[model samples]
Target: MNLRIFGWSYAVTAASLVVALLYGGWEALILCAVLGILEVSLSFDNAVVNATVLERMSEFWQKIFLTIGILIAVFGMRLVFPLLIVGITADLNPVEAVTLALERRPEDDPTSYAYLLNEAYPQIAAFGGMFLLMLFLDWVFTEREHTWLSWVERPLARIGQLNRISVVIAIVALVLLATFLADEPTVVLIAGSLGLITYLAVNGLGDFFEQAGQKQLEAFEEEDAAGPRNGSGPSQLAKATGKAGFFLFLYLEVLDAAFSFDGVIGAFAITTDPIIIALGLGLIGAMFVRSLTVFLVRKGTLADYVYLEHGAHWAIGALAAILLVGIGYHVNEVVTGLVGVAFILSALASSILRNRRLAAQGVETRKTADELAADHTSV
Candidate 1:
């Protein structure tokens, strides 16, 4: 781990802390630093998922994700999205929502932005939880030659052989939670249905475009094998331009938004200062997560740690369950963060052990081959 890979991000974080101190004094600065660290801890799995998608993209698109995509993650999701939620949920205009957010600090009053947001928590949890559950289910159901947790994943995959099993499980889980576990069944039902719909729409759109891109690439490959047909065919150019990457990028952004939903709401529990939340979480989003994605891609960490993605999706599944359960009962964010970290670290340890076994087996095979060669020479 070359710490210098994150030198720029650390510099930016330091600069942001200085600004926080200037704006809100020592207490504000301390809170902001804590929130920043919290964001990084909560979203480590997010970096793993982002790296998986990003490794397939071209260099230009990768740069676009780091530069333009960071803006969307920081400002779009962290700042404006919450306002949009408040505006819609509270029936206030955007400015009114902004006022509501800024008017009540955590210390000032109970009926502040935090309170209103908590009021909207049932629906928020439903939407985010269901969406994440679908992602996890989809991954588990898909057939793979390689698996990390074979005992758990293999059984799930076997059951998942049924057509549309992921959708079925999501709907069933939503219904059970809404009917039996949720405080507001109607809200959970509506929000969860919409969440499922949104996942289908977004995921289906990405798949459709990706299939088209794949076909285009196949056609271009055929044309290339036969020698260039024309100057540069449109299909050839389309494949080169990474239409699939564009759709995957869109999917990744939506996924990131879903992941951030809990973090945004949870931040209020720490501090209800909208300014502090924005500055702290925004810096983490901009500096840390983005850099981690790029760093993982460059270093090929996923290839080395084979089980990392599996662990991430498992952690995501756990988070989704916790969020849904929290609709009726409160679950601490610290618990959620700890669970995610445990899965990731456990997978890392397993991967290291497996690599050692494979290395020893390889050495043994080479030794046997060398002995066989020696025996043949003597004969």
Candidate 2:
């Protein structure tokens, strides 16, 4: 991987370190670096999934995703999002919440922002877990000719033929999680249901708009006879228009938020310092993720490693289960990160092996054709 591809991420790192040093000397800077690394480690799967959605968008929208979307990921989800959680859970105003975060230290202050955020973990876990569960279910159930985990995925795909099965599975998972695995069942139920609903809304909107766009494109094709205009570019944005573009952007942001949920909460484990968490995880970490997404899209890594997406969703499924389990217990962040990495690496290896097999088959087929042609020529 060329370091130049991640130039923006490098800049973010330098800036974050400077801010950390200004905020709290060497100690803060070190902590910031650690948290930033942690976020990147934990969110590799997120980058893969983001790239998958991002590559489908047009060049203009891709720029928007890198710029505007980064701001939302870094500041909106990373910083303000935690505060919103604290404010709502603790019944404090925005100013008060900010004060609570700044003034209180997790080590000494029982009423610190970190503590409040931890207290609200049940709901956070419920919502994030359910949302991720739905994503995982959808990926598994959606029929595909190519599969990474053929044995498991094939069965799931078969079951997915039943209408709304993904939703049904998610609902059942939420209920089971709430009834047996959550500390506060009512809160879990409510949050998990909201997560499910949010996923459905975002996904449904994207599908509806995509269908509309397809119809429009079809009509345009019919009228023109030369085919839908490719314009001056060959990008997903060029292919998208109006509602489709808007909905795709919305879908990406919502998906980013859902993915960020765990990272935000997980940051608390490293340090309860809101500033450090935001600078490290939100700014530097998220910037790297966005950069990684762009890198993957530009390099066509997804096309090369077809099974990588499959591995990512499997990792997501594991993470979802871990989140639900975390509602009643503290799961180590390192373990969580490792599980995701393991799945991703495994998928990559599988893709390589499959490629080798296909290449071998092609070579053998060519050799057989050559022998047949030689025999015919000799006769």
Going through the candidates in the order shown, the clash numbers are 0, 3
- The all-Cα superposition gives candidate 1 an RMSD in Å to the true structure of 7.5
lDDT winner: 2
Q: Give the Å error, residue 304, model 2.
A: 0.6
- 71-175 per-residue lDDT for model 2 (tens digits): 988899999999999999999999999998888575445688888888898998888888888888887887764677898889988998899898887888888
In model 2, what are the clashing residue pairs, if there are any?
57-237, 58-236, 58-237
Pairs that collide, model 1: none
Off by over 4 Å in 2: 107-109, 226-240, 363-379
Best by TM-score: 1
Worst 10 residues of 1 by lDDT: 370-379
CA lDDT scores, all candidates in order:
0.79, 0.81
Task: Give the Å shift of residue 35 in candidate 1.
Answer: 0.4
